[model samples]
Target: MDPKPVNHAAWINSLGMSFAEVPVGTGSILVAREETQERHLALFRRSRNQPFSHAARPATQVSWTEAVAFCDWLTQRERAAGGLSFRQRYRLPSDHEWSCAAGIGHLESATRRPEEKSNRLPGHYPWGRAWPPPQDAGNLCGEESAGDFPDNFIAGYQDAWSGGEVHARASGPNPYGLYDLGGNVWEWCQDRYREDKDWRVLRGGSWKSARRETLLTSHRTHDPENYRSDSVGFRCVLAEE
Candidate 1:
């Protein structure tokens, strides 16, 4: 079935979030154009440490459980406001859905849940396979961040931002037009890192990520459900209920 039409402007105005429809298999899902900002979270009585206090900056120090709660809050808020159809809801994207957003869905593992597929395409950074990364690739640990992360910033890499700042939409969006899929903040996914482990999955790289391995589109990481950090945040996806 065709995806239902969404009033993108209304969503942004009411929720302080924007959505972009990204194709997934036979249907599509509306992904938040950027990471959830502090202002949006504050609307739901959720607040995180704001190093920059910029309302547009990505909300950080947010735990996985909190991210899920935000999704649930958004789902209910929209449903009650008549903005969402009964069959639709907000959620964290699955690992596979995130890969699709990153334009790497083709490398998905055949047998593993999308959350378990890791390091499938090695040596591939978000901005193609090139080394040292191109200018404006993302908000990675770069020369400008050396002062704060003396031992962690990339040796020669630099971007427009400074001091490891997590600017919302600072980096360009992926092919799917979803921002911060590479760097800015690590996003929480719906699945656990593995079936046996209780840890949840985190995708995309964060502003603190300096190593090449972590920036690859296929790279996956995990943390406890209650873990929170200044460099970690999440995006939301609107999908069929």
Candidate 2:
């Protein structure tokens, strides 16, 4: 079945979420330009006291289960409203899809699950291969972050935001026009960390990450599916079934 044409502007205004098309292998998927915000999450789930009180901040302290539930809720709501076709739905991007959106899709691994591909592009970062990072290179832990995370922060790197704060769309978009691919908050992916583990994968660094090892685009991390943290959040992908 053919998919309906999407009115990007109208969708953004109505849903408060914008997406960017990203090519993967033989097909493409629409990736949310920014992480899911608190305002959006509140539409489906009850409001809770979040560390960042701003409506535009990434919705953190969300478990993978909650995130999946949100995607299901959004799919139902949009389909009911005739905004999405039967074959179209919202879900978290897979680890490989996340890498493609982050502009590091070229690095392939021999592992069966693409999520296991890590540390392939050494010395390279989301903002290009440079030491100490450049200005406006997403919301990473820097000197200003020291006040909150006394020991975990880049020594000299700094961005516009202060006090290790996380703000959605605060940093410049990546080459794919996707924002916060490297920082602001760690984003959840659909795949498990490994075939033998039940842990789900997470990509992108967070405002609390300071080490070069963690900031690399090839870096991969995981947590139990039910785990939640102030630094972990997720973005959604719109694709055909």
Candidate 3:
């Protein structure tokens, strides 16, 4: 089947960015412009939900307010450094926008159905069929520290599924060259939880996830501002200047 070429959203490519715009989806995607995936390691030191359960809490967890602050910092930093215009903005993808780009539900042949295109790209997770196939991809912090498992890596797991390295291996990069969009860590989104008053939305299942569907790009988890877990972290993106 010939993969249908996808079109950029009218808002993303044409209208450009309107900071206060409610966004096409109720969230923003954290986009990465470079291969280094920058400052993500700093997310683990967020200092947002401290006094949290270290056993389960990820250091990168932050409140909606904090997320907004981080976004603001990106714009201010870029502008001040003369690298980008102050008018430019960076933020997390709305739940809708994130899913659209997650490449989950997306199949090029499908008529731009939001559900189909999200998972269009193929891989053991995102990178490259579990790095070297059979082997797990990258290391997952929430699973067992940073480097606990050896044989269960991307080069070895191949297709054995479950209990592996929580989807490690550099092979699991997403279609955008983004790594671990499926597992490793459940990424934070811009929405407050749907039901509860919690102020955090989580996409992408964590190392703790067992179901394939849960690991899907569209599955979402909600969390309260006071709660933090090692399973949660985030990526970031900037709007075109």
Strongest candidate by lDDT: 2
Residues 1-241 of candidate 2: C-alpha lDDT, one tens digit per residue: 2122233332352477888777777678888989999888876765334333338778889999989988998998889998899999999998888888877775654244745477667886877788798887888888877778787878879876666467988667776677888888899998999878879989999988889999998899999999999889999999999
CA lDDT of every candidate? 0.79, 0.81, 0.45
Task: Candidate 3: list runs displaced more than 4 Å.
Answer: 1-30, 33-64, 105-171
- TM-score: the better of candidates 2 and 3: 2
- Cα misplacement distance, residue 238 of candidate 3 (Å): 0.8
Q: Which ten residues in a row have the lowest lDDT in candidate 2?
A: 1-10
Model 3, position 19: C-alpha lDDT score: 20
TM-score of predicted structure 2: 0.88
Candidate 1, residues 166-202, lDDT tens digits: the string is: 7877777666666778888999998888788878899
TM-score of each: 0.88, 0.88, 0.55
User: Which candidate, 1 or 2, would have the higher TM-score against the true structure?
Assistant: 2
lDDT of 2 at 114: 48
Report the CA-based lDDT of candidate 2 relative to the real structure: 0.81
